[model samples]
Target: MNASKFGAEYALSDDMAEFPAGHTGAFEVPYPRSCCCSSGDADLLEAARTMREALQEVWLVMDALGAYQSDDDRLSILHSPKFSSAAYRVRTAMIKTQRVAI
Candidate 1:
């Protein structure tokens, strides 16, 4: 399911929207505008990329959890290997339908 299905309940609410056109060198889906680059160090830039990707990872996990909660089984995720793995992990963790011996 698309992330927008969650509406305005996102964690990074302000930074959630796409960067304004011309704000970055290019208006791309994965734009370079997400980073501040205070030191301009190569390692710092790499860290920013990793952090952004991690945020995306958690977003997909939340999305999958929402879909499963709504009982929408048709929401299929074909891309994003890490997201696919993380989604099921989050889905199973959040769901309380598992059997218990109590």
Candidate 2:
């Protein structure tokens, strides 16, 4: 399935339709069954691209939270080394996924 279809299938709630801000809700990534059954390189590439889009959404949520909580000392975890590392890792994975070739 394509990214929009995949997203619609797994969208958390109506509230999440608002983009980065509303994405504060719980997020889940349901593995696509096509990846297990299909051997085509194109299928694999599509799956990779779908996953990359999901990662981008996740990055956007984190970015929104980081910006929203930029001043609150109690929410400083958003600025912590561990959080930064995790965000960096997600971005690296996004780049890798984008490079997948058919």
Candidate 3:
């Protein structure tokens, strides 16, 4: 894995003070392989691990955003039921993939 690809970009701002210095922007997520014909159990495990890791990054962002108090309605959208449901679906997928790998 390219560790640098998972790093968040930093920008200085007053609102940013609540967040960690280096954890402000989006990180790169791995693109799904177009073909998995040659993939083996190890590959599946690695893919599942990658998904879990990527989701963790998302959760970190969500947590940070949730901790932030803003009057912006757009920001509130992130905490909506629909968004929670979507995140739950992804968590379910990760769990299923991990189970299959095990």
Tens-place lDDT per residue, model 1, 1-102, is 234865644343455346564453334576466646544455455554555665667776667657445444333343446567665655544342232111
List the global CA lDDT of all models: 0.51, 0.62, 0.64
Q: Residue-wise lDDT of candidate 2 within 5-42, one digit each (tens)?
A: 54645544676666686455657798877654456576
Evaluate candidate 1 by giving its C-alpha RMSD to the native, one decimal: 23.3
Ranking of candidates on lDDT, top first: 3, 2, 1
Q: Each model's RMSD to truth, in Å?
A: 23.3, 21.9, 22.9
Instruction: Evaluate model 2: give its lDDT.
Output: 0.62
**TM, every model:** 0.30, 0.32, 0.31
lDDT of 2 at 31: 80
Instruction: Please list all clashing residue pairs in model 1, or write none if there are none.
Output: none
38-96 in candidate 3: lDDT tens per residue?
45666676666667765775675566566455757546667777567657757766766
Where does model 2 exceed 4 Å of error? 1-36, 41-70
Could you give the candidate ranking by TM-score, starting with the highest? 2, 3, 1
